[model samples]
Target: MKVYLWVDKDIPNVYGQVAVRAGSIDEPADFTGLAHYLEHMLFKGTQEIGALDWAKEKPMYEQIIKLYDEKAKLRDPKKDKAKRDELTKKINELSVASSKISKGSEFPTLIQAAGGTGLNAYTNFDQTVYHNSFPAYQMENWLKLYYDHFQRPVFREFQAEMENV
Candidate 1:
């Protein structure tokens, strides 16, 4: 469901947001922080938004995940230094390889280029909301970007985003 408010004021910008009823409070105890983490990922991109070449990048991205999974099982980096360093090196290599195919910021850049402003999203106790203001004439463009975001989002930059969290 989508909701829109058409203000009749003289302002030249249109303000709106897409929200879901689910939030942090709805998450299971073991999945705490999941909602906010997902919110952060949404900005990372959609398949078509932040990708420079999905065909080439996909394999590299998968490799990163695989490497990290193996790394996770290693115990005490100080004692498992050799294995830890090996996995980290491989992960870094894949990250660099995949990053080269990244458009990285195509989402927000698309909106900003089209005269959209205040593009942002947040998650809290009861809801996660994505909001943006666009020039009145750019409403259609805004919708196009927003729909792309939700319909085909890709979780890029997971490592960097997780660190920030």
Candidate 2:
């Protein structure tokens, strides 16, 4: 990770950005939009940051991924409409259950509560960037949040987040 800082006495807030080299270009051709989907998931928070019960949520989260994998394997959506619909229903059911135990918006909520603004992320062909502005004194807090943000992202609320992407 690389860091850059710009300080100005007149500005009351600190604007921070963390950009990673991976983006759409890094995604596998078969999985186009994977990078953009990841950008959205990263905000969903990590194992330590978002889960009310990681032990329970983990299994459901895994099941959701498996269902998606299974759904993806159905080469003919129209022909396999019945099977695809079943998988979609299962995915949605587990997603809602998993969400109950997950802190879906805790990451952004924490930032907003701390006087942070412009909290958002974006992905392009070459890179993805997460950024926000916060009171200068909260620099340490911002660093800690982001440090945990990048570690072990849980992918909770996968279905709802997928809609956003």
Candidate 3:
């Protein structure tokens, strides 16, 4: 059965989250970070939330991968200066394009329309959490914002999401 809850100061706030009960540890070695990436994408919202222009989001998302890929290379104490600089350039290019997707976009405006703030989401080692804290009256709006994504999502791409962490 469907249920509802809230989290706030006045009335008691209630909400829900899904626990996968597994993670990268359970995936095939070839899958590597696939599980981790999928965790992040889960919150990309779904067809129901709104259309996710993946065509355009893809290029932006790829740069996100470049950003993380460069960071990974930098971690090596013996990493070559030339190679590092090359990756850095790619990352910068991608970061710039990715920022465009987030600039004053309607998504932020709609999420805020729910009558609350701090409606955010995250992915972790063994879990993916999608939640928000709003005043009691915003339950329906909040639910609409969260439902389709929680039910089924279309994330930009895991490679893009890694940039956030």
Candidate 4:
């Protein structure tokens, strides 16, 4: 394995997140919430940040589950927005107790901190990730925290993060 690491940490801000080895294409069958739900739930972190409070957030996550499910079959825009909005609200409410922080703001900070600039992300049918590369001096550190997040991320503000996006 090519163990990736960030070697630089100068400047100011530093943000990090993880991209799972799995993606929508890898979602299991018979499990409606397989991929998107897993994506949502993935933010539920490890022992480091704190245990995932699924009890309180389950309903909100479920709402996102519903939105995603409905959005998939949705052919009507009006109904879709309403459904999406409702689910988004639940997610926001639950986010207060989650670790699904915003990747948009986070990754850029990693770049800026390492004394580089500009960072962003994307998703496709097959996968999704946080991606940024910079000057040779800032290479590893620019990407370090992201890998760190992979091991111990808390899906804290997924919907809130989504709202900002």
Descending-lDDT candidate ranking: 2, 1, 3, 4
Model 4's alpha-carbon lDDT is 0.50
Candidate 1 regions off by >4 Å?
3-11, 68-86
The predicted structure with the larger TM-score, 1 or 2, is 2
TM-score of 3: 0.49
Candidate models: Cα lDDT each? 0.84, 0.88, 0.56, 0.50
Collision pairs in model 2: none
How far out, in Å, is residue 137 in model 4?
1.3
Full-model lDDT, candidate 2: 0.88
Which stretches in model 3 have alpha-carbon errors above 4 Å?
1-9, 12-22, 52-109, 157-159, 162-165
Per-residue alpha-carbon lDDT of model 3 for 78-119, expressed as tens digits?
A: 657667777667766765664455432333456667555665
Q: After superposition, how far is residue 22 of candidate 2 from its true place, in Å?
A: 1.9
Which 10 successive residues of model 3 have the least lDDT summed?
A: 99-108
For this target, which candidate reaches the highest TM-score against the unseen true structure?
2
RMSD (Å) of each candidate, 1 decimal: 2.9, 2.2, 6.9, 8.4
Worst 10 residues of 1 by lDDT: 1-10
Per-residue lDDT of model 4, residues 83-160, tens digit only: 767665665454543433323234345456666644544444576665544566554664455555466554544454
How should the candidates be ordered by TM-score, best one leading?
2, 1, 3, 4
Q: Which lDDT tens digits does candidate 1 get at residues 104-143?
A: 6788899889888898888999999988888877877788
Count of steric clashes across candidates, in order? 0, 0, 4, 13
lDDT of 2 by residue, 2-121 (tens): 777777878889889999999999999898999999999888888878789999999998888889899888998689999999999998899888888889788998888789999989
